[model samples]
Target chain A: MTLLVTVFAAIICTILWYKRKNDEMRLGTLCFLFWGASLMWLGDAIFEYAELHEEFFTPAPADMLNDLYLGLSVVALAMILWLIILLIKDPKGAVRRALQKK
Target chain B: MACFLVGAAEAIVVTVASKAIKASESKKELAVRSKGGEKAVDALREKQGIPWSRKLMWLAYLLWGGAFLLAYEHVWHGEVVPWFPFLTAMNDPGDTAEMLHEMSTVGVTMAVIVTVVWALLCVAADLILKRRANSPLENA
Candidate 1:
């Protein structure tokens, strides 16, 4: 479930990044982040599949909720990190000037 | 919170480790090249900063993605509400297939919402950056 979520996010991000390749919003970074996540999830799915075999596909409801929470949390964490990076880069020095004023 | 904590911890560890490795590599470059001087050091740093660090991006990706997947097995048996007041087809998870299909509907809706929000954020950030660049203060 988490793998599916990340893959979906990655595919969307990749398409967005490709279309806005020349933009200063640094879509490339976003693409890299999502794709990296997708790959990581892929690895996890493989290991789980190996361990649980057929049982992996039909997860219990409780299991699904946990996966859903995990998926949401991961997406949130990525957004947080990216926001921090954007602030640091402050491509326009907005943060820098704000700090200087302080 | 457990999922978030693990993800945050991994991000911090990966970033610090990458920075340490980069710092060490800088020193190694200085040792290997006797006459490259300050120019060489600057070049190395530039290379590191050009378009941002792949290590940093990958760290976020792996930690975020990996942590979530790891948490799934640990929490999969948890209960979830499966109800759609308007769409009867989307309600009542009688079995795994029906449940997953319902979940997929929710996932698609959430993903679409997230993507739209992210794009808007990028646009706002770009506008802020451009505004600063064109400011009278900057021109002065």
Candidate 2:
């Protein structure tokens, strides 16, 4: 699930980046982030499959649900991290203005 | 989760590099300041570093919140075991295997579902973008 989610994010980011051809949003950074995440998950899946062999074909539902949670959590964390970067950069100075308005 | 973390780390690297490049360019670069004491630049950022598809940002954020909340509820309720190998057949510490084979079918199923949903989201967004571009107001 994590792999799939990252793959999806990577694809979406890439498309948006390409369409806009603009880096002000740091879409390139975002696109690379998701893509790297997807690859990592893919590697983990492969390693687990290699270790488990045939047993990997069947997994308990509870465990699957756990993976789903972990995947979603990772995505959330990624967004949070990106948001931090955005706030620091403050491209439009909106935050600075709001803060200065006593 | 580990994979995602690693990806985020990689992204940070690229981001910092991009910033460094911009900072190096003393000439061709201008950092304007507003009355609010904020530095402004001529870049691709629409506002506050948001992408062109502002809706997409909010949508992704809302969905992520929902998923995170729901997942947390399930984890808290013990509906899903919080094991290290949640995706592997080794989910249960008690369960042991002689030889490894293929990835878990259940895991594959979950991955597929996530990918499908994501594809749908992107396709919908793309369609909306295209339509908006064609709208008379945009052309006018």
Candidate 3:
């Protein structure tokens, strides 16, 4: 259920970002990436919490699956930060010109 | 809860910092243009008439900062649950709590490092942007 929600959220945000490509597009893109990663992280956290509480009995395979999900979340976050740095940097030609002026 | 609060504070700090940097940049720009005989640029120096979009950008910065803080907290310490769940595979409640406390120490350290790096990057980006904006082709 949590995974579904996360995927849905990412889809919606991505759609919105594409729709606004010219208007603060970088900001929109960064936001979409950030939220997408966040939702995924939230989903895994929910699953881990459930496992910790023993709400769902998980076999060895399931435990491994949970670990994989957690690892993905970390990777997603790192990507989000990279996206942010790109967003914050001056847009393409803007940076090159800025550098030339210096 | 502590993480959330700290995140909120961080949001405010980032907002203020971004605004200060922008204002300074604009002032410097005005000073340059004024010296170059562009009297019209002096009007911008008053700063009483900043555009609405810039204001919105500042708000966005605040929101992003808050979200970053929230994510940092969530990663270090599990989200708070009102009642414990019934999963046996979970970490022990007592141990979880202890781990969270320890996690906060790590979180603080990480936050400081990330924030410093972010600030430095922003400064570099700003300088680069300013130079680009001042270029002759851009001015033309």
**Who wins the TM-score comparison?**
1
Residues B1-140, model 2: lDDT tens digits: 11222223333443455455545443223333332223344342313232323433333332333334333434544543567644333554433231122224423333343334445666787677677768999889
Q: Highest lDDT: give the candidate number.
A: 1
Q: List the residue pairs that clash in candidate 1.
A: A62-B76, A62-B77, A62-B78, A63-B76, A63-B77, A63-B78
DockQ of each: 0.10, 0.06, 0.06
Q: What is the lDDT of residue B45 in candidate 1?
A: 61
Q: How much DockQ does model 2 earn? A: 0.06
lDDT score for residue A57 of model 1:
96
Q: What is the TM-score of chain B in candidate 2?
A: 0.38
What shift in Å separates residue B133 of candidate 2 from its native position after superposition?
28
On a 0 to 1 DockQ scale, where is model 1? 0.10
Model 3 lDDT tens row, B18-85: 67777876777777786765655655543434433354343444345435534553543445443454
Could you tell me which 10 consecutive residues in candidate 3 chain A have the lowest summed lDDT? A32-41
lDDT of 3 at A13: 54
Name the best candidate (by DockQ): 1
Report model 3's TM-score to 2 decimal places: 0.39
Comparing 2 with 3 on DockQ, the higher-scoring candidate is 3
Which ranges of candidate 1 are over 4 A from the true structure?
A: A21-23, A97-102, B1-140
Residue B13's lDDT in candidate 1: 72
